[model samples]
Target: MPYAPSTVNQEQSRANEGPEAVRAAVGRARDAAPAWDALGHRERGARLLRWRRVMARRMDEIVALLESEAGKVRADALVELAAAFEHLGWAARHAGPVLRRRTVRSGPLMFHQRSTVEYRPYGVVGVIGPWNYPVHTPLGSVSYALAAGNAVVLKPSEHTPGTGRWLAETFAEAVPDMPVLGVVTGDGGTGAALCGAGVDKVAFTGSPGTGARVLAACAPSLTPVLLELGGKDALVVAGDADVEAAVEAALWGGCANAGQSCAGIERVYVAEGVYERFLDRITLRAPEITGGPGGDYGRMTVPAQLDVVRRHIDDALARGARAVVGGPGSVVPPYVTGPVVLADVPEDADAVREETFGPVLVVNRVRDAEEGVARANASAYGLGGAVFARRGGVRLAREMRTGMVSVNDALAFTAVGALPFGGRGRSGFGRIHGADGLREFAAPQAVTRRRFAPPLAIQTFARGPRDLARFERLLRRRGY
Candidate 1:
């Protein structure tokens, strides 16, 4: 018997659709794009609202699928699903205003012209989603793409293909006739095919290595790609921080979803003044949070990730780092690994420099907030981080070189719909949330119209030496 019979059947059916399935799906999306685009932003938003309602109605089902397929605990799955719903609502409610055409003031030389900019969809977007937060992450691309009036062809992680199919089916109920969204279930090969399948753009959320591969595959066709990749996020605790609150944020930000999240906190820097107190609080609270087949944090979804976690811990310990909570014996089985916390870990240790992507936290002490921010900004990965400071929260947060930072909380920046979520360097580029996200799926088109005949015409053959002199005078006066 299959683990998830419905999901397995759906996958099997999609597989039977053959080698050309990705191409076929892209073709269908292409055929559907014009009509969908013609519906305009408001109409597309209405359809997204309908889809959001359907998803809300099937919240339990979605959560169950998320748990079974992604190995997420009940609470974690609920959080992911809730985030997806929130993105859907935000995309639906704001797409119109965000994508609306905006008029701009004309230059003095072209005073008789009216200038405006419009956002147009890219027609089709190919999205490759990750197993961690399978629903929420991909929907970050899907919701915005749909709102921008582009059809989507999503290839979910093989570990959680079922959840992807379920989402596509739910979306179908909202727009039954149009092929606005299509799910192609397969492994990396399918994802590669989707990228090479002539889609206008590709939105991928996965490891940086995989993101590089996606970039390579899309290169042949010159397809635009938006990548949301891995991170080795840090959490800094200042001397004036609330130790209790910082401890809570550390635990949740580090261990939630079995530490499978790309934005999960993997390293921590605590000021010398409050280092011992922070460690005491974390050591006391770490044990309260458990990980197993059935525990506060569920088993690691991808089996291979367990070895990566084990290797990082071993490397940390081999370099004289002490395990404050969990250590070598923390590995429980084929999929589960308990949370591990280390102190005095070397700067060059695998756990500190690399993305463990596990329920592990390396706590390092710093002389002060200056040192904390400096150390946090040293890493190549800068997706997300948190700064817990009573007096200089925002200032310290600004000092850290990450995409998103929470002043007093952990991962709170992700919950806000208006803030753009993405990173620099190896954490990947191109945003996925907010106004930037909506604009990511669309292309900007500038429109300029002649409001009246200008005394000094410059754009046409009607332009003469007098017109050129007038343009230069205007440029000089405007400081151009």
Candidate 2:
């Protein structure tokens, strides 16, 4: 069947101006940063809260925009919007304490003086977000940056320009007088310009390949960056795992958002004893999941990704793997590929190695829990992993090389508002969400004010022999 070309224009043919326009937006953001940053946290928080209300009131409009641009189900679009709203609330409520100066206990000698650390905002932050979870990912950066007192210039993925437009419109309603946030929509050139446009920092979310380019662009400016990149996360099913529970988790974790999520599980390593049964159950249910704007799944957001999905499927079949449920023919066209489960896929196969950013899963048997852990860790991308062990969920989760691990459940690590969210190695670095997210846009400044003179001078030209002997003895006793 012929596929429906993505409603979104990938070349950003429909998107307004390329790099030059984005550069101008960045200039405006940089010009407005000082005034925005000078506002008190309470005032800033009120403006953010107003935006939050705007998001709540216009949920339907936002959802519709999201569906057209991203091709995700209406409910799924709402879910992303809700998550973005939550982060906005979280940042606004917590920013004051998180960024305020706090007294630090100085050791004995320094106790005579008072010391504290305060966090200051970077001037401007450029946020480059992905098409998948467009609202949540971009707002994750935008909200935190605003709460930390920095002006933000956002570049939503070319495939999801409408979502970006909604976000900017909402903010404009909340803080009409303040140029707190701006949006620039385009393809790679706009994103590249944002990185090099004299922004104090950059926050990017997308594939690792694109992340590499973002890193290189920011390197020349020595600008710090927070990258939330791709992952080929794994789900490790230990021998002790409940078969029904593990299967349910693996299916949803791998297929949710049509498997477009960076933290979604693409690989499943089950213990040898239950491997066959697990694969059978998952494959059996894969086809029933459905895909469309009205259904649970939806059309592919990027038309080119359909080709990538097909290629991964073809590669797996050529490597002797069989799709127990959906095959190439099962790839329901018009930008909607139904769920597919592949068994006997070699570890080295492209399907298993690359991020098949579609509803596809690769199942492999492991000798034991040890093998399951090893296979999960073997991937170059260590963004996230899941463990379904009955007695050792926490321990097994800790052992995974990824930055986050879900125990007894898939994607649970993301809902916790307290945990820092990020990945390592090829999955990318820096964080969003939790306390770390708040700190990402701010720099810590340590202040120490001298009070009275010390009994023995350390930094004076009139230091005596007794003072020198005392310092040496203290150092010797502490083994310094």
Candidate maximizing lDDT:
1
Per-residue CA lDDT of model 2 for 375-475, tens digit only, reads 88888998998999888878878888999999889988776656678999889999998789989999999999888888878668799888999988887
Give the Cα-based TM-score of candidate 1 against the true structure. Answer: 0.96
lDDT of 1 by residue, 130-224 (tens): 99898899999999999998999989888888788888888888889787898888888899888888999999999999999999999988999
What TM-score fits each model? 0.96, 0.94
Model 1: weakest 10-residue lDDT segment is 1-10
Candidate 1 regions exceeding 4 Å error are 1-19, 335-337, 470-478
Q: Tell me, what's the RMSD of every candidate?
A: 1.8, 3.5
Q: What is the C-alpha lDDT of each candidate?
A: 0.88, 0.84
> Which residue pairs collide in model 2, if any?
3-334, 4-334
